[model samples]
Target: MLKRLFKLGLIINPYSGIGGALALKGSDGADIRQQALIRGAEKLSGKRMAIALQALLPLKNELSIYTASGEMGEDILSSMGFNHVVVYQHQAQQTESADTKAAALELIAQAVDLILFAGGDGTARNICEVVENHCPVVGVPAGCKIHSGVYAITPKAAGQVVAQVIKGELVSLMSGEVKDIDETEFRAGRVIAKHYGEMLVPEELRYIQAVKMGGKESDELVLSDIAAHVIELMDDEPDTLFVMGSGSTVDSIMQELGLSNTLLGVDLVRGQQLLANDLTAASLLEHCANKPVKIVLTLIGGQGHILGRGNQQLSPELVKMVSKQNILVVATKSKLQSLQGRPLVSDSGDTTLDEMLVGPIPVITGFHDLVLYSVGSM
Candidate 1:
């Protein structure tokens, strides 16, 4: 249980991940002319609420929650039976980033201990764009391409960890992944993941940890070999959306493909053409709208996160369109060994997307070989 009298702020972007799932061509989509709910948005939002409810339920007697108005904040609390938990005083509608910024600023003004939010990497970037490390921040994943390290493994897990932090449980705070992607290219089957910055953990959250790095260092020769195999696969394929994620490993693939790629950036490749490079969220989605796409990414060695690290451009909204089957993980055997006993930490800032990526998945590093990658919770 959490210690008493912790004032927390809550905010949500009720429509954050809805656009891409609608095939509407962007992550900014909040309305559909078709008059039905977008499944992607609902699922992500539902997961956030569930994890939050479960995590906060045990601490109701001792804590107070201050939240934004309407779908973004109150509904989650209402569903969890939090009538007395003072909702934030709203000055306007709950639809834009301004709303989030306003509410966040208000929360800070009120001296809230921390703010728990649910959104994507863009959302995290928005918060970080305006606010600093004045107060602790946590994320409940409910967006598409999350690359921000503000989120926990699950919404409930986020809540549980926050509770632990409040109780001063000797946890360690690690620098989180601050990444965001271009959603426009994401649609046209292109991806441009960029590192925005890092976030701070409250030091009591055990379920959430920093992305780990290898201690032994890299063997340039092996990376070269793995990169060659991935490029060969790319060359043999028919005209397809080749979404190349970031990192040195992927850069090797681009070199073999004869395409000039951003060394530490996401790039879009389709057959002989280089579609887009170094794009933002809006850019990736615009490209992926109606294309046949294949995602090629290398796993983060020790953290095990294939998409969340240097590739935040693969948002939940984007992932929904790509589906789990479309994702291809490329890593060498040596790399897999490094990740063998760790959880693929996804501080993508969106809890729901991380969950979607959790579990044993195939790691394709060399030709005709795939290893299963498993996620562990500490």
Candidate 2:
């Protein structure tokens, strides 16, 4: 007897994370994508999709893939030697939101069991516009701003979820929120997220990412204490270069140090003074060459992600150069409690670095306060 084939649909937003490494905040508008290209930013949606598709390789004979042509899907499937049919075709050089919507509709028409897409929140919103709750979808995190709950914690994790479904495992379906922020406000260091709608996603608590929590930490005293402790560390290690990451928690620390900060971008500080503002991955490497460096980061509210959410500027190369020991995580105790016992995730896009980042790490919760938390790559 022959085994039934698992029909899977794939969509890759070729320009999804184009603006991340360049510090443009998002790849929303065509103008922003163009600017990112001009600044030498490479589109990583395909690469991220490839990561998610790796786990499906062993089951290729029992799988059938339906996707769009060229960079959106066909190219990747071809390169990976997967059997795929192009249900939709578009100009590979310039794909747009309309293409994504059309592809979603085509996939639905084909009655695919699942639609796996790679991009950030904007891509999720695009799919939500057409598919709604009509089809089950899985998101591969490959965007600059991933505030939606539909995506997996990482690309590889997305593949694992799909693999479970292929093997006829009991995968529960849940409505995942599709959220997106205004790029204009985001570039200005203000986050204005709005709920677009929901989609049916495979429920895997350990794999799926939670919706990003909006607003600042309301506990001013806790933030003050955390800020004071970071300031003390800065004073003790005056010669050490501190790479300040994004988030309200880290911004509060910068406020306490009386230094201007790029709230949504990485900043470099030394001797209690801001060395550079909004440095890209390459620029960060250039500036921190052969210097004693420590990276200070904060968790992404409900998500519990210390890396690979929005701070793509901290490339895997930079993370490796600085080493895990030099990383400092700051979060309020209340913030940590909001996770409901989920381990912090490190989806740095490098599987090896993410694995190396695993294990117990200390988080600064208050002034002279530290809590041990386990970090994992899901």
Candidate 3:
């Protein structure tokens, strides 16, 4: 009798994170990808896929892999010495969302037990379009805005979840959301995140990221109090450069200071004066350099992410520039209570920084009020 091998499907969006570091803000269009490449951005989806696949090395002989041809899948699997069958061939040199959907359909046809893909929310949307609830999938976080619940908190965690499934361990299945935002509105400092649909995913609370909570803060009184406290601080430190992060909580502060805020983008202010609006990563680094900078941030409602969800503008370099002590977090008491005691997450894509950020930090809940909370990364 022969052992029945665990069959796994793989798909890599080779251009997923190409526009992130370059400040293009998304990898959705071919023209955007070309712009990023011309500006010297390298495709990092393959490298991210490689990191996730590392954990499956020991179980190689006990598994069978299926994937798309070339950079979409085969290249990385081949480099990693995993024997895989190319189930679909991409028609164009540059892979599109259509390629991802086609590859997923082929994988379902092959009856793979689980599909593991690397990309952001856009990639998740493509997979959901074809697979729906037909097959389970795991996503590696490798895009500009990872505002979806389908992705693992980190690349290594993604592999670990897949490994559990491959080892025949008890991994629960649940519906993961496929959410995306209009890049046009996003670039214009507006966040209109909408739920496209859902897909069956292997559930691991420690590994899987939570879906980003949408809508605005409804407690007008609490928002006003929180905003007042932040304004008081700004008055006390007249010389400090304030970097306003995204979220309604921070936006409330901007409103109190009598300044227009970028609803879904980073802004800059000094002594209650608006200096800049909707800055990119490079712009942030240049402006924040050699200044006494303090970053005003707020956690994502249900996700508890203070960094690396939609605020990719706060790149690792910019975070380091401001230092951890200079970060001021504000959220309503009810908002913090909604997490039910899950620590805040800082999935900044830099393992070292994420580790460095682990500890208790102060959160301003109201006027002259603060509470200590823990921050962690998967």
- RMSD (CA, Å), each prediction: 17.3, 21.1, 20.4
Order the numbered candidates by TM-score, best leading: 3, 2, 1
Candidate No. with top lDDT: 2
List model 3 lDDT by residue over 1-378, tens digit each: 244567799999999989999888899999999899889999999999999999999999987999999999999999999999999999899999999999999998886767899998899999999998666789999999998888999999999988876664434456688999999899999999999998767754221221114433447877787788888888999998999999988998898888999989999999999999999999999998998999999999998999998788999998888877688899876687788777789999997777667654557776755555557546
Pick out the ten consecutive residues of candidate 2 with the lowest summed lDDT. 204-213
lDDT of 2 at 316: 96
Model 2, backbone clash pairs (residues 3+ apart or across chains), number: 0
Residue ranges of candidate 1 with Cα displaced over 4 Å: 1-4, 23-26, 29-47, 83-94, 203-378
What overall lDDT, based on C-alpha atoms, would model 1 receive against the true structure? 0.64
TM-score of 2: 0.54
Higher-ranked by lDDT: 1 or 2: 2
TM-score of each: 0.49, 0.54, 0.55
The segments of candidate 2 whose C-alpha lies over 4 angstroms from its true place after superposition are 205-378
Least accurate 10 contiguous residues by lDDT in model 1: 203-212
Clash count of each predicted structure: 36, 0, 0
Q: lDDT tens digits, residues 1-378, model 1?
A: 222365677778666666556665445533441222534334356457557767677777656778777776787688787743444555645367777787787776655556788888778877776556555678888776666778877777788777765443323444566788777667678878888777555434222111225433245655565666566666788577878888877777777667889867778987756888876656777888788877877767676666667778776677767755577777655566565455445556666666555433445544433433443321
Cα displacement (angstroms), candidate 3, residue 182, comes to 0.5
